[model samples]
Target: MRVTVSQPTRRGTRRSHGVRAPAPTVASMTRLLPVLATAAVLLAACTSDAETPASSGCDPALAAWADAGFSGAIAITAGGETVCEEGYGDANTALTVFAIGSVTKAFTAAAIYDLVDSGALVTSDRVGDLLPELRGPVRDATLMQLMTHTSGLNGSAGADHQPLWRADAIAAIGAMPLAFAPGTDHVYSNAAYTLLALVVEEVSDSTYREHAMTRILDGFASAGFWDGAPAAVGPRAVGHLDDGSTGEAGDFAGPHWALDGNGGLAMSMPDLAAWTHALFTGGVVSVESAAAIADPVVDLGDGAAETPGWVARDASAYGEPFLAAAGGGGDVGHDTMVVWIPSEERVVAVASNGGDVSAEELMAAVGPALAAGDPIPAPDAPGGTVDPDVAAAIVGDYRLDTGGAYRVSDDDGLRIAALGADAVEVLFPPRDAAAADAVRTHERAVADLLAGETPAGREELAALEDEFGPVGGAEPAGTIVADGELRTYATLATGDGPLLVWYALDDEGAVSAVEAGAQPPALDLVTDGDAFRPADPAGTGPDVTVSFAAGVLTVTGPDGAVTAQRD
Candidate 1:
């Protein structure tokens, strides 16, 4: 999502006329020292001498570069201690922090899990049953599918509006339709999660912000959590754009558009680290729920070359590091990477306004530090392909290994399933012959629109749409798999990127699943692995095989004919 602070950004911008100034010395870096120390102790306890961190403060090889480029914040906490805390440039150009784009998903997940913990709701509950206002296929979607992103309400391709005005976002999503049946496949969808926030609001009988503040933010006051949705978060960090400029970090200018479940959270680096610590060490949710969240629910292993951690795609070099147990959020000039280092018994939280580039830098800087027990250099090299052109190039229809269809469309266009709500898009629309034709036509229209489109600040929106489909109302429970857990993969590519729920057993032995989108025809759900050679080379042809390893999936088609892996 493209988020701009109320204050003017750009090299020669100034503060807003009547905004309240940010607090001076909101929180001293020293406050984090104790936390860092505790974390160091914790880390030392968890690792052997070989894995122990270096005693010296590794040179700021990465930090120096970060200081030069973007006005940023850095916090390194291990175990329970805070090892490093610093803020460079301006945390608030006009009393606002950088918007942490999609990092907000972690918070949304936490809040939803709170409701689940309190018996207020369950992930498996159908969207239709709880959030009745939802019509179309979304009505049938389950919260689990939404959380795991397997809800097939919207196909892989749909309209996006993260960087636009809030009304535009709702309007665009409203115009689209679900592209596939719910629980049919995995498609990372911010729109789906944003709608989920609304669902949480309805179920809790309170605003999403209130729910998060009360149950999450407020509950963690001891850990430095603060209350801020539309308002400025205290001790926040500044975000920098690729234009070689920096600005105050905060949510978009639209008042109604606070950090939604899909993305839209603002916080300091220290606070985020604490939040991650709670998540990994059972401070946020119960161990059972945490385990469940981290557990792999389905496999997307067949007919795909490689598996990605978060988004389902074949290539990993271009995408963000997929954290099996962690979550990510970012838009335009804001980003956050929160990782739980279990081997070290610590949580590492890095929030930046440098957009997608931050993911790579954080990984580059911290990955080696954690692995080699050494310090990271400043201004770590940017990761992933951050070019707007590169991101846009991949924006098109992609056939998911799962049974449903997946596509990426321009930012403003809408997508709908056959016979689904004309105004309200769903994960999977009601498939009637008439509606399917219309949906196909809609795809063509969107392509035309994109071809004539200009850089009207919807690039982030386009990326979001490419990342997810339109907001489908309801669907079933689902999850994505990578390897067995959410660890980052460097050299190898294996397993399913995201597992889509395609079939279920019934009383009459009737195999029920969502209708396939525009994918190659397949007969059975079983698959061995991406390599059709079969796990057992001796196995005969017509072998529809499915194998679940570590937590990721790999499927080999019948006769070892076709193979696809979730990226």
Candidate 2:
């Protein structure tokens, strides 16, 4: 049996095939004078025979970050006292606003819990009960299922490049077939959260943004919804791409309002720190609701737990209970992570503008130090080399279940083209003429380029630039081992920011899968003379193998064999 799974598209020009959300400093305040004075006296006494007294600030980890070329803001709070608060490079914690990406989900989830507390909604209520117009399997899903991404709904309704009315988007999502039976498995669905946001609007009789502003961010400083418009807010740090280019928050592609419930919040590091603090301290929601947000409701079976809005991991590293939420924009920019240690009443929030550093790395380096209130050593750099043989075998054509063919070319270091509608359309259906035209142009350009017609392809690419903006070329980034698979990363520069492409190979070293913009159909077999064998057979139908002849590919698995022709 051929099983099709819906994959969520990362918003922005660079799409990540893998699910990795991608990380700071400081301090001076008159209020700390008393503490500083006392510390100075104690330090002087201890160092009476020494030449200098120890500094009052106790964050060597933060100082180390500045030394490591970190270019963002960081805020750390412990026991209701501001432990470390500082900015690095171009970031200013007091003024520079950064897009928090999916971290917005936390605020949305908190709002839902608040509604439940107010007797306006319930976790058990079916989606159909709240939004009667939502049809199909999704209608039978409970709000809790939606919150935990177990709604069985498609991972995404589609991307939002064109202007899409929320009502119409909801209806379109309702029309999509469920990936599986509701509540049976785990699939991250931004569409589910978007629907939940609609539920919030219906229940509160206000827009999702409005509700969030009033209920979630009313008291926070310098935070607001990012509607994909140019930054009207000043002092905003532009997101940096892998190509060393910069663009305002809205410069990245994708629908802004459409990502509202799932992602779309922009704020400063201090504001995010404040929000997390308020969230866990019963300031935004009741203590019970807050606790529920951290409680793991779904076991991903990968040692990761999914809560309403946070991802929970083992507390062994922190030596206490820990919860973290992360968000990123497409591939190489605007990454943020917030970590909460409930037992210690500690919160660590980090935000970076470029992909050079990741929140996970920052947290890993700082978590131990923050927990111990002393700086620890920095962790090793992430990345490694791909097997030369594995890299050579991964060049070919792949058919996507969502209706497209991904062509991987080894001509000049692995370039790719989408034969039909690119994956972007699968998640974000074109709602306007411009979006539709762009999609067509992209398809045509890829086709021409794959055929080795550089001039014509470049012409089409130029047209795309005219429609969009300056498009950057793709370059090799690096490689890493994920889930026991060695995947290569490539960076694509766009008007918005840098996007990364992840290519996965099968056991036999064939290009078994490619995830960029949207999920492509997995490649199961590669031609070996006249015969073909399973490449990545795990989680597939059967172990049977077959042969290819007469320009047709025949695949036989346990269930049986099927024949398909090149498109």
Give all candidates' CA lDDT scores. 0.39, 0.54
Model 1: CA > 4 A from native: 1-59, 67-71, 89-98, 153-175, 219-232, 244-259, 298-332, 355-359, 365-567
Error of 2 at 151 (Å): 1.0
TM-scores across all candidates? Answer: 0.50, 0.59
Number of the top lDDT candidate = 2
lDDT by residue (150-180, candidate 2, tens digit) is: 8876434544333457777777788867767
**Candidate 2 wrong stretches, greater than 4 Å:** 1-64, 160-162, 228-234, 251-255, 301-303, 314-318, 365-375, 378-567
**Ten residues in sequence with the least summed lDDT for candidate 2:** 22-31
